[model samples]
Every structure is written in C-alpha cells, then in structure tokens.
Target: MDVFRLHFDIDGGSFASAGNASVEVKKTLRQLGVSNAVIRRCSIAMYEGEINMVIHADGGTADVEVYPDRIVMVLEDHGPGIPDVELAMKEGYSTATEQIHNMGFGAGMGLPNMKRSSDDLKIETKVGVGTKITMVVRL
Candidate 1:
C-alpha cells in the first residue's frame, strides 16, 4: 500500500477536544485494515502526546505517516521544553499545576505511556524552546 499521511492541529489547554487526532488516526487505520493491536498502540501513544501538548504546550501539530510495514507519529510543540528528560521519563513525576490535576490529567504517565506503547520513541527538546517527539510502531 502507498504511504498514507495524516495531519492535525492540536489545541492547547482544550481538555474537551483532546485525543481527537488519535481518534481520527484510529479510524483511518481501521479503514486501512490495520490490526486492532497496532491500532490500539498507536491510538494510546498519540493520545498521550496530544494531552501533553494540551497540558504543557499552548498547542502543537501532529503528523502521522502510515506505511505498509510501520506507522510513524511525530508530535511537535512550541511550549516550554522539558528540563530533565531522565526525570520526565520516570513514572509518577509531573510538574503540572493543581488545576490540571483537578481535570483528571497531568498524572505524569504521558511520556511513560508513550514509551510503553511505541516500538521506538525519540524525544528532542531545548530549555525555553519546545519539544518534538517521534514514535514508530512496526506492523
């Protein structure tokens, strides 16, 4: 199959609309006959990334490329960059505000869940700049 590409503009701080991109991607994958397991992984990872963008970054962009043997997701944001990647990787470590916690998010599982769900994950960030996350799942 030819490579399929999908793009979405994630709105920051919009709890109500979070995960829309992941949902759309899941639907597209289903229409393309992707396995449920793979779809679930992609959806979970993408949803986590989307939530991170909403919670941390003001907004961002998500891009997905679907190939015959794999799917790649790239999430980019222009928010404050993560200061400590190692610390952020740890489960249950978060810097979110109490307001965010009240909304049922900011549990510090976003990055961990992304890593657990993706076959390969890469994170790039700079202090005071932004962050970019790329994840790949093999078919």
Candidate 2:
C-alpha cells in the first residue's frame, strides 16, 4: 500500500499558530485524493491535539502517516504531564488557566473529541516529563 506522511512542529506560547499543522495536513490529504469524511476526522483530531500542545505543553511535534486503510497521528509534547488522564478525558474537566479560557479553549473537549474522531487512541504521560498521544482513524 502507498503511504503519505507529514510532520509538523507545533509552536507553543502562540495561539496564532495553532492548528496550522492540521490545516496543512488537510490540504495534503485533499491533494492525495483522500475522501472528505476521512480528511475531516483526521483534521479535527489533529487540530485538537495541536491546540492542546499549544495551551498546555508550550509546543510539540505532530507526525501524520496515511495509508490505504487508515491514518495515524502522533503528537508529542514536553509539557507538564497530566496528573489524571481519566479525569482529563471527561467532558468538562480542564486544567487550563483563565488566560487559556479567555481564548475560548480549554473546555475539556480536546481528548474526548480526539477519541470521538479517531478509531483508536492511546496516550502516555509522565508528571515531570511529557505526553505522547497516538490517534488512529480508519479509512
């Protein structure tokens, strides 16, 4: 099977550049003739991951691998790791500060939304280290 890959560095501390990776990936997938439905799901999941990397981790890396039957998105960040992943996964549980809330984000939907948009999801985090999240979407 043919493969299409994309890599992006998410810039932390700047909300202005958030979601850039997702936008570029969407364009790349469209150019590759990926279906709109799959592109939408992939973009949404990537965008949410990007936003999280920005608001929490300061910055991170996102790698997207697209295959004939599925797409995988990996996001890695060197931020304060989540203390409780289960609680963080809840619909309205967010640890974002008021500054982030002022930006209209941190509603606690990022992980949940990512899970909803992807066929499979995995997250690994260490309190003092960082976080790595892998999300897969079936094509």
Candidate 3:
C-alpha cells in the first residue's frame, strides 16, 4: 500500500478531547483494514503521547505515517522539556503536578508504554525549549 500521513493538533487542558486524535486515527486504520495488533499498539501509543502533550505542553502536534512495512509517529511539544530523560523513562517517576494526578492521569507510564509498544523510539528535548518523540512500529 502507498504511504499515508495524518496530522493532529492536540489541545492542552482539555481532558474531554485528549484522545480524540487517536480515536480518529484508529477509525482511519480500521477503514484501511489495518491488523488488530497494529491498531491496538498504535492507538495505545498515540493515546499515551497525546496525554503527555496535553498535560505537559500548552499544546502540541502529532504526525502519523503509515507505510507498507512500518508506522511512524512523531509528537512535538513546546512544553518544559524533560530535565532527565533517564529518570523520566523509569517507571513510577513523574513530574506531573497533583492536579494532573487527580485527573486519573500522569502516573508516569506514558514514556514506558510508548517504548514498549513501538519497535523503535527516539526522544529529544532541551530544558525550557521543548521535546520531540519519534516512534516506529513495524507492521
């Protein structure tokens, strides 16, 4: 199949619409006859990224590319960049405020889950600048 690309702008502070992009992507994948396993991994990974963008950044952008052999996702945010990527990647470690925690989110599982779901993951960030995460899942 030819490559397909999707772009989404995530709205920060909008819990009600946090996962809308992922849901739409899931629907698109379903319409394209993507496998269940692929859809599940992509949706969960995208959802986690979406949540991160909303909680940390004021807003952000997500791009998904569906290729014949793999799916590529790029999430970019202008949030306070991760101070310590190694620490952030550790399970149960988070900088999320209590307000976010009360929302039943920000349990520090986002990066870990993204890593687990994607075949390849890359994270780039700078303090006070922003963060960019790229993930790839093989089909």
Residues 70-93 of candidate 3 have per-residue lDDT tens digits of: 999999999999999999999888
**Shift of residue 65 alpha carbon in model 3, Å:** 0.4
Give all candidate RMSDs, comma-separated. Answer: 0.7, 0.8, 0.8
Question: Per-residue lDDT for 1-97 in model 1, tens only?
Answer: 6899999999996889998999999999999999999999999999999999999998899999999899999999999999999999999999999
Instruction: List, residue by residue over 27-126, the lDDT tens digit for candidate 2.
Output: 9989988899999999999999999999899999999998898899999999999999999999989999998899899899999999999999999999
Candidate 1: stretches off by over 4 Å = none
Candidate 1 backbone collisions, by pair: none
Model 3 weakest lDDT span, ten residues long: 91-100
State the TM-score for model 1.
0.98
Give me the displacement of residue 47 in model 2, in angstroms. Answer: 0.5
